[model samples]
Target: MHPTIPGFTYRRVPVADDVTLNVAVGGSGSPVMLLHGFPQTHLMWRHVAVELAARHTVICPDLRGYGASDKPAEDAEADGLTYAKRTMAADAVALARALGHDRFALAGHDRGALVAIRAALDHPEVITHLASLDVLPTLDTWDVMHGTGAAVGFHLYLMAQPPGLPERMIGASADAFFGHFLDIWTRDPQAIPADIRAAYLAASRASVPSVVADYRASAGIDVVHDQADRDAGNRLRMPVTVLQQDWGTALGFDAAERWRAWAPDLRHTTVSCGHFMAEEAPEDVVKAVLDLLTR
Candidate 1:
C-alpha cells in the first residue's frame, strides 16, 4: 500500500525493454526529479514532492530494484551490471527524456542519491542542478565507513558479500531487517508514519535478491566505476548542494572535504537530523533542493 504524492499520477515509464521505472508525476513548470533509496520507493518523496509540486513539476521514481520497479535477478556473469549506479542513473535520464524533459533539477536520498551522483557526472548537460541527501560518493562512502562508523552501516558490508548468502540471510527476516533501519535512522520515529513503514517492509521483503545485488554491486563494480572517475579526474560540474548529518565527525573523516573534491561547485552543509533527512527533516531537505535550483 505505497500511496504516492496526493496530486500525482503514478505511471510505469519504459526505460529499457526489460526495465520500466515506476514514476509519479504532478504539477507543472520546470521539472524536478526525486529518487528514493533502499528499502523504500518513490513514496519516500511524498511529502517533499507535494510541496515542490506547487511551484515546479515533480517526478519521483523508484530506483530499479526497489518499490514497484522491475527487479532483475543477480547476474553474476554480467559483473554486477544489472544494479550498477551507472545503469540506474541511465534509467533516470531515459525516464526524464521519455517524459519530454531534456533537462531538470534532481535530488535523491540515500542509495537514490548515489544514483543521482552518477547521473550528474555522466549527464551534466541534462542535470541542471543536483542535491544529495545523507550520502557521499561510492568510493568516499567506503572510506568513511571504516573506523567506528563501520558499525553504523554493518548491513552494507553484510549485503556486499557474495550474493547468495546475503540474499538468503536477509530474506529470512526481511521485515526485521527493514524495520531495524527505519527505527534507528530517524530522530523522531513518528517521522515515518506507520503505514509508510509497513509498505517499506513489504516492498523490501518482495525484492530481497535485487536489493542484495544492488548493494553487492556497490562493493564490486560500483567501486570500479568510482575509481575510474577519480583516475580520469571526472567530477560533478553542475551546481551541487549536499545536506548531511555530522557523520564525519563521529566517523572520523571530513564529510565536506570529501564532497568538495568531487563537486567543484559544491555547497555542503551539516544539518541537524538523522540519516533519513527527507523524512526526518523535510523542511530542511525541501529548502536545500530549492536552493540548489537557485544556485
Candidate 2:
C-alpha cells in the first residue's frame, strides 16, 4: 500500500467510464479539494491536508492517469484531449459530486493547478473559491516563454512533440527524468523524506506515457481552450489565490498581472521557496488556503 495522508480514508471514486481517481478524503465542515502536482500524488498534500482538516473537509485525489489512479490507454492516433485540463477538470468536479459535494473550494499545485484553473473557468458554479500554486493559465504560460529563459521548460517542448518520441525517451529513463525535477525544484532537501521521494519516483516511473500525454495536452489542446476563453473574455468569478516562486524577474513577465486578468479578486504572492511549495512550505501554503477560504 502507498503512504497516505494520516486520518484520511482512501477510496477509488469513478469519475468517467473507465477512470476512477484514487482519493483521500478527511475532516468535515466546509468541503475543500486539493489536487496534487505532476511527478507526485495526493500524498504531496499530506502535510497541508492534515493542517487544513482541523477546520475544513479536505479531499485530495490522485488525478486520472496518475498515481494509483486508472490510466486510460490512448492510441497513437489519439488527439491528446484525453489528458487535457478540460477533461481532467471535469474529473475533479465529478469526483467531488460523487463524494456529495455540489460546491466546494478548490486548490491545486503545478500540473494540478492547470486543472483547477480550468475547473473554475468552465464550472464557476461548482467552485466557491480557488487557489493555484506556481502556474499560469495555458495561454499565459505559452506567452511568457521565449529565447534562452524558456530553456527551463525543455521538458515542455520535449513532450509537446508528436507522441512517440517523448513517450519512448521518457519511458526509457523514467526515474532519472522524473527525479531530476524532485532534486532541482526543491529548496529544502529534507522537505521530502527519503520514503516520499522514493514513492514519487516509483509512481512516476510506472505512469510515464500518461504523464507525457498530460503535458502534451498542455502544449496543444489546453492552449486552444485558454485562447478561446481569452477571446470570449471569460474570467474566474470566484476569489482566487496564487502562490509562486519569484520567476517574473527571470522570465520577464508580470506573474501577478497575468493572473489578475483571469482572477479579479486575486491575491498573488511571491513565495521564497522552490516549485514544490506544499512540501517545502506547507505552513505558508496552509495559511494561504485558509485565508482564501475566508475571502
TM-score, every prediction = 0.97, 0.98
For model 2, residues 1-295, the per-residue Cα lDDT tens digits are 6688999999999999989999999999899999999789999999999999999999999998889999997655657779989999999999999999999999999999999999999999999999999998888999999999999999999988886899899999999999999988998989999999999999999998899889989998899999999999999999999999877488898999999999999999989999999999999999999999999
What lDDT score goes with residue 242 in model 1? Answer: 93
lDDT of 1 at 199: 84
Residue-by-residue lDDT tens digits, candidate 1, 129-221: 999998989999887787766898899999999857898889898999988888888788888898888888888999899999889889989
Instruction: Give RMSD (Å) of candidate 2 vs. truth.
Output: 1.0
Question: What are the lDDT figures for the candidates, one per model?
Answer: 0.88, 0.93
Candidate 1 lDDT (Cα, 0 to 1)? 0.88
Best by TM-score: 2
Worst 10 residues of 2 by lDDT: 72-81
Q: What is the C-alpha RMSD of each candidate to the true structure, in Å?
A: 1.1, 1.0
